[model samples]
Target chain A: MHIPDNFLSSPVWASLDALAVPAVAVVSRKAQKSTDSNRLPLLGVMGAFVFAAQMINFPVGMGTSGHLVGGTLLACLLGPWAGALVVTAILVIQALVFQDGGVLALGANVINMALMGVLCGYLPALALFRTRWKWYGVFLGGTCSVLASGILALAELALSGIRMPVALLEASLGLFAVNAILEGAITVSVLRAIERLNPSAVREEVVRSGRATWSKVIAALAGVSVVLTAAGVLVASTLPDGLEQVANKLGMPFGKHPAFRSPISGYQINSLGGAWFSRAAAGLLGLFLIYVVCALGGHLLGRMRRSYL
Target chain B: MRYIFREGNTQDGVIQQLDARVKLVLLIAFILSIALLARPSAVQLAVCLCVLAAIAAAARLAVIQVLRRALLVVPFVGFFSLVVFLSGDGQRAWSILAKSYLSALTVAIVISTTAFPRLVAAARFFRVPAFLVEVMQLIYRYLFVLAAEARVMQTAFAARGGSTGRRALEASAGIIAVLFSRSYEKAAMVYQAMCGRGFSGTLSRAEWRPLRVSDIAILSAGLLLATVVHFISI
Candidate 1:
């Protein structure tokens, strides 16, 4: 799922590259500020461990085997922020040394696999790790992480104007679903086995049974927005006509002049003249407001809590 | 498994001697130009390819080898382009496939010539965080070792007929668990060793020399070539 160079159009890549630099900085800061300064070396060795773990394959039947994707597993072992930093380092090494991904596409890959994958994976792990449903949460985290990344990858490609037939899109989605399940299964079993072996390895972080950490709540909210954003795109792709009919019932005045003129007047880019364009425009802008709302609410909540303390 | 990057390529090439910072800037500008080009005639594509080949020759790398390495992007891009082709836009499909291939070759060539450690140093020069760069350096250093260890475990497991039953999954997890513990212990040892050597939070960088006039000349030439390619296509 590593995007190669030139696969993304300029706007998509440029904007993502802009977004990723700060994101990486934030996580790197967190990793540095983390209590265990020893985690620096641990991060590197853990990265190598995940990289090498790929060599040990799990048989998925029919003479095929798949290895760990490592995002969720990394989150389980290391905290998500540090885990994200490790994944980012792994990605850079992969791009530069192995040609696994393109240099320009590094930002997109980092956002998708490193940031989103680890955060989404960690949300579930945080929820389930101390409970009887610990393993199930791990499985869900793995699946959600992979699935989230895959959807974002597909959406980016689509926005790049790569037109896939509906059938191909569905087929790829199905493939991603299968891959997600396998990742989930692998994460569950591996974490379980590690828990059994060192007894204390998995419990290092697991013993933290406090109120959901401030960051976890914020990450969960961010994860929800990511899922919503992807969902908006998917919905716009598949159900635009129905949405439009509902819009008309509520009287958007698409061809009329009584109401205020929205920027994308008919949910379409003015320079473009396709139903798909309108759907895409609406999907992208619609959720952006929701994301902003989430951000502001989180900020206010954080401030209020800080003041009370 | 074999290591993918052949380290010796950085040893003798003239391209390898260029300032890593200059090369980094030039490579990015070149790739950006390639990505932004909307449509190029077949003549333009051939011209770009020839120029790329000439650059490879200048680097003392085989043009064919760079082409072959760049073809790694084809399977991934080809599938997308094939769908576009099947949808009846052969020209757009070709543009997507060919342009991305050219861009990939450009990246592969630059990376081949520059040592990754040098590149990391360049990245740091360009404002990548000190800690992140250090972590990346460590990961690259240990990658081959851990990969080899993993291969040995996989082979041992396979030899023991561990692939047949449902137990293989658990056993595979066990392998990763063991790997995790070993890596954890190794990291502890590494930290101690580093601290023994008067380690600090940051790693030391390579000795510095200012970029020479030749570096600027090469960069200008590269940018001019990128412009030529863009306008030539236009």
Candidate 2:
């Protein structure tokens, strides 16, 4: 789900980055506002739990295994902001320290797996849960969220420079439908467990907990995250996505270069660098920088919530 | 690596010593470079590989170690995007596949070099929002709990001789329902526990030191190299 560097243009990519910077901050703030002090520890524990759960690969049909990407699960327990933030952390750890995804594409990955996945999934699910059709809402909201994440992935790809042709889009959409169904089923199973635990208790624990300040802070963060996410969307690349098979047709200058000459060319925007170590270092720095900003924003939101209380 | 992840282990020495941040940045740069190279000249790709190899060597990573770790994605990528290879022109498809593989491999190198726990710590250090970090932590924690639950449920089903054909599917569905119920119950329990503590709106931990001068120096050098390469490629 992570978009590697050199995959897209700077103007578009940077725009997305710019958007993410504040989106995370605002959302973190919003999430803080809704927090209950008592729920803080539980949320913390849950965060760790989610991280661990991602590592356990469940056997699907055939020899391939798929891990649960419980975006909606977390959203259901905590909220959308928490879900987005948690997924972001997971992706960051996977890419930066674990090397599961590329550094340059960290922003894209965060947007796809964290921002889009959690936000889209959580919002609708929360809505549905709050609406008349509690059970059906859970199923439908979860399904939609997966679709949102999948579409976001496609969007990220396009922004990063994939030229999605009509045929490609159709094929990709078909594939996405399959992926969504599988993921949706898994989500439903997880949510049902959560529901049986007692939604009222879950709600009480989150909203009535002593961490009133925490809730405020979380809310503020959410506000910030949403703003940033929206901004990123605006700035995101307008290029075609993976569904677009028209890379050669896009008529971009570098669209049709000799392939054999540059095997490593696609990963990095620049290929003639002196040391991979240094480039990698820069990427790590950017990742850290992003985290620092987010943390600072969360801290501020916390303080603001405290003052309000 | 053993010191960081485990107290002591025979396989501890196999891990690299580079800070997680350093590895992260390098890998990112590697990925970005790959993404940007577009239709790279074969020579450029070779150079990129050399750089990757050098980093791997510096990190004391073996080819097999990295490949084995990275192979996890091959199935997914192959299942999903192999058509990009088989459907396109032979030369073009070869180019696309190679480019994509290099990109994936670059990421694999980063993962193989860095352990998961440290990676999470690094994410925290970078200042990801507390809410997000906390959820990541919880997900990781509950993953095992759920898996164990799933296993137990499956065993129970099997023991009851409910593991045949159509019944298996029904049992699977039933298992999902069971898993959901248990996880929810557990979440409620966990939330109650949190209320006892003085939890605030924000999750906090000791702040990490910002990137030092040495870190900045290393990063600058990398950025400079990338800038130069980007220009050359262009």
Evaluate model 1: give its lDDT: 0.77
lDDT of 2 by residue, B12-73 (tens): 33235446676556655655666555456677666666666665565566755554555554
lDDT (CA) per prediction: 0.77, 0.55
Q: Is the docking of candidate 2 incorrect, acceptable, medium or high quality?
A: acceptable
- Top of the candidates by lDDT: 1
Clashing pairs in 1: none
Error of 1 at B164 (Å): 1.8
For candidate 2, give the lDDT: 0.55
Model 2: per-residue Cα lDDT over A1-309, one tens digit each: 454444444434544665576776666556655665545445544554554444434455565545556776677666666666666666665554344555555666676667767755654455445457665656665666566666666655544334444466668767666666666665665555455655553354223332335654564466346545433432333333321333344544443221112323332325445444444444444445555665676678779879999
How displaced is residue B56 in candidate 2, in Å? Answer: 2.5
Best candidate per DockQ, number?
1
Misplaced by over 4 Å in model 1 are A206-210, A238-309
TM-score of chain B of 2: 0.72
How far does residue A100 in candidate 1 sit from its true spot (Å)?
2.4
